[model samples]
Target: MQAYDAQTLVLCALADGPLHGYAVNTAIERLVGTRLGPGSLYGALSRLEAKQLIEPADDAGAQPRQRPVRLTPTGRQVLERELRSMAKVAAAGLASLKVNPA
Candidate 1:
C-alpha cells in the first residue's frame, strides 16, 4: 500500500510491545494525537508484515479477533535509526529557523 507515513507511525507504535488493531490505534493516537482509520491501520500492518518489519507475536489471552503484533529485531533497529534521522532533521530545521527573543 501507499501508507508510508502510516507505516512509520505503526512501526513506532509497535516499538513498545505487541498490540492489536484498536490498541495499536490507541497507542499511535497517544504518541501523535492522530487517529488512524481502519483502512490505514490495516494497510500499514499488511505492508509492514510484507516487509518483515513486524510479525504476529501471539494471540494469547486476546479476544478471538484480536491478533497482537510485535516488532522483529530488525524492525526495532530500523525504528531506532528512523527516529535518529528524524531527530537530526528536527534539530537542523530548528537551527535554521530564526527565533525572536524578547
Candidate 2:
C-alpha cells in the first residue's frame, strides 16, 4: 500500500512521465497550490523509491546535478488502479449529489 498522501502519490505518478526534481516540484506546486517542504518531499520520494514505483534517472541534460524521475511499470499499474477507484468513488458521490442537490 502507498504510505504517501494524495499529493505525494500524484506527484510520483506524474514524475513517471519523466521530469527532474525541480520540475517535479514546480509542477506539483502548480497542481497543488503550494510548494512542498523538503521533509515531506524527500520522505515521499523515499517511499516511492522503496515501493519501486519511481526511479532516478541520469540527469546528463538536466540543469546541473538535477536528477530525473521516471515511473516504473508497477507504478503505472498502481496509479491506474488508484485513478479508476477514485473515479468510481467520485461517480458515486456525483450520483448522490444529483439526487440531493444543495
Candidate 3:
C-alpha cells in the first residue's frame, strides 16, 4: 500500500457519501480535527479525479468547482484495502507499546 496523507484523509471523508469541495472539507475536519485549506483540498481533489478515484455527481445547482463527488468502485476498493493495511500497522504498533485493547 502507498503512503498517503491528505489523499487518504480526502478519500476517507468521501467514504460516507458524495460531497462538494466545501462539504468534503467539513467532513474531513470532523473526521480528522483539521480543515484543509482551499489549495490543499483542491489539489487533493484534482489528484483523486485524475486517478479516477472519484467523479463528479449530478448536482444541478452546483457550479463546476462545487460539483459533488463520489468515490468510484475502484476508489472504494482501494480505500478499503488501504484502511485494512493501516489497521494492521496500528495494531502492531499498539501491541508493541503494550497498549490495552479498547
Candidate 4:
C-alpha cells in the first residue's frame, strides 16, 4: 500500500469487470486526472500481471483489438488491503489537521 501511481489504482478498480486499455485510460483520467499513454498503460499492466494483481481476459471487441483484463482473487485481496491502509492514512491525516489547524 505504498503510494502507487493513480493509473495503477484505476486499473485495479476497473478489474471489477473486464475492460480494454482505452476504457482504462479514460477511467484513469476521470478518476485521477492522469493522461496515460500506451507505453505507460501496458507497462503498468505488465508489472501488475507479474505481481498477480490482474490477469488477461478474453476480448470480444470488433477491431484491431487488445486483451481485456480482470482481477484475480489475489488482486481483489490486495486492493481491499490497500484501500484499508489508505483509509487509515487518511484518518491519521485528518486527525493531525484537526489538532494543528494546518
Candidate 5:
C-alpha cells in the first residue's frame, strides 16, 4: 500500500481503541487480509504522531515500545471524513461496473 494508505489503515486500526504496535498490525491484517511490513507500520505511526493524529496512551507501567496509541479527537474526525469519501468513491466505481456492493 502507499504511505498515505498505510497511515489511514493505522488510524482505522486505532478507531475502536488504543493498540500497541503489534496489535495495530494484527488489527489491520484482520481488516484487510494482509499485514504491513515493520517499516510501513512504524513509519505510519511516526507520521501520524508527528501530525498529532495519534498519541501514545498512558500505560504507566508499560515499556515505551509496548505502550499503546490512541486516536486524538481530530484523528477520529479525520478518519470518519476519509472513510466517507472512500465510500463515495467506491459506490461510484461499483455503479460504473454495475456491481452491487456486498
Candidate 6:
C-alpha cells in the first residue's frame, strides 16, 4: 500500500480503542486482508505520533515491550473527514462508470 494509505489504516485501526503494534497490524489485516510489514507499520505509527494523531495509551496492564496507542480527538476528526472524502471519490468514480454498487 501507499504511504498515506498505511497511515490512514493505522488511524482506522485505533479508532475503536488502543492497540499495540501487533494488534494494530492484526486489525488492519482483518480489514484489508493483508498485514503491513514491520517497517511500514512502525513507520506509520511513528509518523502518526509525530503528527499528534495518535498517542501512547494509559494501559497500566500493558506489557513493558508493548506500547498501546489510541487516536487523539484530532485523529478522529481527520479520520471522519478522510472517510467522507474517499466515499465521495468512490461515488463519483462509480457514477462515471455507470456502475451501481450492490
TM-score winner among the candidates? 5
Tens digit of per-residue lDDT, candidate 3, span 1-102:
333488888899999999998998899888877888888889999999999999988886788568999999999998999999989998999999999656
- All candidates in order of lDDT, best leading: 5, 6, 3, 1, 4, 2
- Candidate 6, overall lDDT? 0.89
Most accurate candidate by lDDT: 5
Candidate 4 residue-wise lDDT at 15: 53
Model 1 bad stretches (over 4 Å): 1-4, 60-65, 98-102
- Candidate 3 clashes between residue pairs 3 or more apart in a chain or in different chains: none
- On residues 1-102, what C-alpha lDDT tens digit does candidate 6 reach at each position? 443499999999999999999999999989898999999999999999899999889986777338899999999999999999998998999999999955
**For model 5, how does the per-residue alpha-carbon lDDT over 37-83 read when each residue is reduced to its tens digit?**
99999999999999999998988578755889999999999999999
Summed over model 1, clashes come to 0
| lDDT by residue for model 1 (1-102), tens | 222388889999998899888889999889787789888999989888889999888766775238898999999999899989987876777777854322
- What alpha-carbon RMSD in Å does predicted model 5 have with respect to the real structure? 2.1
Clash counts for the predictions, in order: 0, 1, 0, 0, 0, 0
Worst 10 residues of 2 by lDDT: 1-10
| Stretches of model 2 off by over 4 angstroms after superposition | 1-16, 60-65, 99-102
lDDT of each: 0.84, 0.66, 0.88, 0.70, 0.92, 0.89
Candidate 2 lDDT, 1-102, residue by residue in tens: 223364345444364477765667777767656656777666666677788987777665665327677778888778777778877887889888885423
Error (Å) of candidate 2 at residue 56 is 1.2
User: What is the model-wide C-alpha lDDT for candidate 2?
Assistant: 0.66
